[model samples]
Structure formats: C-alpha cells, structure tokens
Target: MQTEEGMVQDMKVLVVDDEKLVRRGLISMMPWDRYGMKVIAEAMNGTKALECMAAEPADIVFTDLMMPEMSGFELMEQLKLQYPRTAVVVLSCHEEFAFAQQAIRRGAIDYVVKNDLETDVMDEVLERIAASVRSRADNRPEQQEASLHPLFYEGESPVRLHGIPGTEAQLMPHGDSAQQASAEVCQALWQGMRWLYEDESFEQLLTLTAELRLPQSQLKDMVFPVLLKSGYLLLSLEHSLRWISRLEQSRRWEEWREVLQEERSYLRNLLFREKHAAEVVQGILQAVVYMHGKEELDFSQNEVADVANMSRTYFSQSFKGVTGKVFQDYVKELRLYKARQLLLQSSKPIYSIAQQVGFKDEKYFSKMFQQQYGMLPSAYRNQNPLRVE
Candidate 1:
C-alpha cells in the first residue's frame, strides 16, 4: 500500500478473502505502493466487505471466490448493482473456469486465478482496469473538440481569451492563481456542458480553463473533478427540463430559457460547418425541437433528410450513428416522453392527448403507450390521473 506522503492519492483498493494467509501473501507480494494504490480496507467475508465498502469506498476490489458467507460472486453482484463505480477483480484457487466467467458476466472488471498470480499479469490487469476507469469518466479529447461549448457568463469569452492553442493549461490548482484557474475551468465546463445539449464543442471551454499554469499533481486532480462536474451539470439540466419545467420561478425560467437558446444558437453555428459530427447531432436536435407537440406532423425519412439537407441514405446513417437510435425510434421516444408529461400534468383525455403529441390514431397511440409503459392508456390514466393544477 502507498504511504500518504508519496501516494498518488487517487487510487484506493480493497482486498477481501476468507484466508488470512492468502490475503497477507497477496498484499505483501505485489508492488501496490509503486502503482499508486493503497489498501484502504480488508474483509474476511462478503458481509464485512459490504460494511467496509460503505464505510470507505475503494476504487478497486480484490476478492477471493470462496468465503464463509457472501461469496465473491454475491459481493460482486451487490457491488455491480449498487456501487458500480467500484471495479471488481476476482480471485480463486479452484480450477473452475466457470467461476471466472460468471464473475465477468456479473460486471467484475477482470478475474485473476490464484494459481496464475504473477507480477506481470497483475500489472497488466491493473493498467487495463485503470485505463477503463479513466475513459468512463469523461469524453475523449476528440469528442470534446467536436461538441459545442457555451459560456454562461455575459462578460469576456473565456475560450476566446485563453484558448490560444500554444498556452499550457494547469490540470489542477496549487497556489491562489492555480486555484482561481481551477474554479474558472470548472465554471466553463459546467456552462459548456449545458450548451452541449445543442452543440458539441463544449470541451474546448474546459480545456481553455485547464490551460492555466499549475503543478502537474494539481492538474490531475482538476481533470477528474471537471469531468465529474460536467456530467452532473448535464444530468441536472436534463432532469430540470423533463420533470420540473414549470416549478422554476419566472426569473430563473427566463435565465434557463436564455441559456438554452444560446446553446441552440451555438449549435446552429456548428451545423453550418457541415463536416463535424457535433453539427449532425445539432441538426437532429433542432428537428426534434421543431416537431415537439405538432399533432399534424409526420416525421418521414425523406422529410428528415430534407431538414438536415443531406441525402436520405446518408442522413439516416449519420442520424443513427450520432444519436444511437434510428430516426423513427428517436421520434417515437420523444413523442412518448412528451405524452407522459401531458398525461401526468393535464386533464386531457387519452385521444386528445394522443393528438396533441402527433399521434393521429388513438388505437396506434394506445398500442404505443402499452409498448412503452406496459399498460393501456385508459388504465394508465385511471391509475395516474393528472395532478390538479
């Protein structure tokens, strides 16, 4: 385990096993300290492991398959379903290949046999697992460059001022200047991510902030938090738009609408470029917003192609590629989402609600509703009548 004085400070690991001898052997054999990992806790059984996890969560788990209770598989299942952020690496002396395979299925990041334990293999697994962890944390540089990044404040444009291509940004803050840079970077990342709903270049805004000169150690800290905050901000914005649109005060709503509008405008600017995938996503979102609540609208492939100003074949391909769904599916999902809102908030009948959300036939609407919500529209309405306004 790494000591506090020289540790990377980011890597935290947990070792769980029934056999104390084996646990101590594994811990003593590995150069865990060199790898920047610290053994935060040890547990003799699955139940104890869970307690340890709740008390001090570790980034990685090394567990033995056989234990007095709560075997490795059960612990892995609990962790996978609950604290999915923690990666599991299972171990066992038993020559049962099925046990390892099952571990993989349960979302264990990797499985290492006790018999196969070697310095080289352990190193390889650790490196691969660490890389995977980092990748899942944020979009790659290329992805960030392609997305639209919006600045929230009305004053100086941070991207324009700091993104001069040659400037080296600090990853984290150390002194007063570095700390200020970190704050600025975080703010820019938050605002840029909001704009990313419309445009894709939001990463440049963060990069511009990160470019402030700071120590290498501080810089690493800055990157992960910025990425994390960006994701949180995006999720919050999405939830607000979907569930609490009217709950916002008028002043707050006006501010929200203005930010959304600026984001949309920034995306439109990106779309003119015609070459970026962000532009393609921007175009699709524009189409989605335009069709919202238009009962008379029918989103044909040809119409979408025309709206996006591309061939039907190319448009369909790029639309699915960028959004991870076919155009038809995307439209259907959007309509269902809106319909759910209307059903919960308005006193409209099922047929009227269907028509309001672009479904012409009540029968088709009911069928689609059943497919999405697993209940008939009438039953759904009866169970969840509109809230009194």
Candidate 2:
C-alpha cells in the first residue's frame, strides 16, 4: 500500500485476540492497506499465535493481554528470548491497563485499548511501529557471516588432527593407544569447559580432571594434539610440547612432574576465569531484564548483585567492563528512556508518569529527565505530542 508520500510499503502483521468478534472486527474493519500493513495471520490465543509465527513470521504482533493456554505475558517473555526482533503491541481493555503497562515494561513497543479501537488510533500505532522497524533495519549491518563451528564463538578452533584417522582406526597398539588417550583427554578438557560454563564449582572441575586416566608416557603426545585441535595458538602449543620433550630427554621426572602440575593448574584456572566471565555476562542480561520488568526505580546494584550471587564490588566492576557503563549510569539511562516514552504516549500527569516509571519524587524525576534530554518533561511532551487525541 502507498504512504502519504505515495511510496509503496508492505508490513506483515499478526493479530491475536480470544474474542471472536474482536478478532473479526480488527481484521475486517481496520484499513490495513492504508497503513501499509497486511493482517497476514490471526490467532485466538498465544499458543495459536506461536504456531502462526512458526508457519509465517510477521513484522509485528498485536496480541491480547489475557488468553487461554498461554497468557500474553508468557508469550511475550518467550518472544523476547527467541524472536527479539519481532515487535509486540499489546491489546487490552480498560481493566487490563495495568497488565498492558507490565507488558510494555517487558519490552513490548506499545499497547492499544480495545474499547477505543478506531481508524485513527490504529493508524498512529501502526506508523510508530513501522518507523521503529525501519530504524532498526537501517541501523543493522547488511552482511553477517554465519558460524559453521559449534565452538567458534567460545574461542575454540574447528580444526582437528589431519593425519590421524578415525578414533576407531587409531586404537591399535602404538597408534591406537595414543589416539585413544588423546581422545579421552580432549573429551575431559571439553567437559571441564562445560562445567565451567555452568558455573560448576572449580573444585568439581579439578576433581573431574584429576580422575581422567591417561598413560603418563603418552600424556604429552596425547594432550598436545588435543590442545592444538582445541584452538590453542600453535606457538604456545609448540613451546609446551617442546618443554615436555626436553624434560623427557633429560630424564628429569621431578621437573616434568612440576611442569605437568603447572599445566593442569593453568587449565583449571583458565576454565574458572571463562566461567566467571560467562556468569558476568549473564548477570548483566538478567539485570537489564529485571530493570525493564519492574515498575519501581528503587532497585540498587546491591540487589542485582545479590541476584547474580556476586559480591557488590566485583559485580560493579564486571558490569562496567561488559556494559561500558557503571551500574547507576546504565539504570539511569533506562529510567529516562522509559520516562520519555511515557511522556510522548500517555496524557498522564507528570507526577503519575514519574511514579509509574519508578520515580518517587516528581521534581527529582524532572531534574534527571532534563539532564538527559536537555529539556523539561512537559516541554518535551509538547514538542512530540501523542498522535491520538
């Protein structure tokens, strides 16, 4: 369909409502073409909506706040995890406004009151959603290389030993035994990494690694190749292998033991650090989700750190390292961003808006808002008024 500028635009939409009449009315009465959107699919419940999405993905989902089988909030949580790019617009009645607000806090772009459904309201919502979609599209890079290896993102190389045949073939006396030992060491190493990723205790990883059985004579030969295959730098692997060989040639069993012990310690420490880094990333993600889902702005770094099961000092350092912003700065940005959206979309009084977005004092909220946007909240609202009267 053509926009006011006469440029053709097409956006796929999915409409979901449990009420048969409401579903039919939205599909039939709304001028989807005029807004450059097509009601490509419809579902009576969140379950059905998910099925429809699997069959044919849509640009936007307009879903009811409450439904059988799966509630709108649950579906939205799933969508945020799985299809983060798909924008959701909640449909609610007057009584469900609170639920709608919760949905917005949880990443929904907007909401519409069913009782106030009209051509103009739908038009405004559609335009806003379309503009957001376009902005995201424009900002995203055009080309992205698909990963071919499972461990690629984990800093592991996809390369395997070239000369060694299958593990079964290499299991014969000298060749087979060494290959078998290598395979076992590799498996143990990967298992240790997995344990670290799951935040399993470092003691557990150390114990598991210690239990792995490999011939001491074959340990260097077996472990070196696996380390190389596991994406370790060639120079480092070569240096390690050379050190082990020199120890063996000199018959310095005591020194060899010391070196091997150091290697094991290093591996354990590496896995622990990797696990800690992963946990930090996960903690930050959870914090952002919590910030968005809550109505009150009273949460603190201590609380979030507790949720992450990390010390406040360490959590703060990791938060800054990963997000490039301190905890307070990041939270302030989120609060101000949400406040700005509320100012533009709702006619709620300044005090109410401040409270809704988690500000206890309106004056403080206005001061922070002005600091962020360089203008008073009221002036900003006046400049970018809601499309709907």
What is the alpha-carbon lDDT for the whole of candidate 2?
A: 0.59
Q: Write model 1 residue lDDT over 65-147, tens digit each, in one string.
A: 76766878788889877777677877765323234335544656555557666777777656655654454333233443232
Model 2: per-residue Cα lDDT over 265-342, one tens digit each: 554354344345666756655665566667666787788888767899987887666555678777777677667667
Clashes of each: 15, 3
Cα displacement (Å) at residue 372, model 1: 1.9
Question: Candidate 2 deviates by what RMSD?
Answer: 20.1
- lDDT values for all models: 0.57, 0.59
lDDT of 1 at 148: 20
**Consecutive 10-residue window with the lowest summed lDDT within model 1:** 241-250
Estimated TM-score for each candidate? 0.35, 0.35
Model 1: runs farther than 4 Å from truth? 1-200, 207-278, 292-299, 385-389
Positional deviation of 260 in candidate 1, in angstroms? 19
Candidate 2 off by > 4 Å: 1-9, 95-97, 140-389
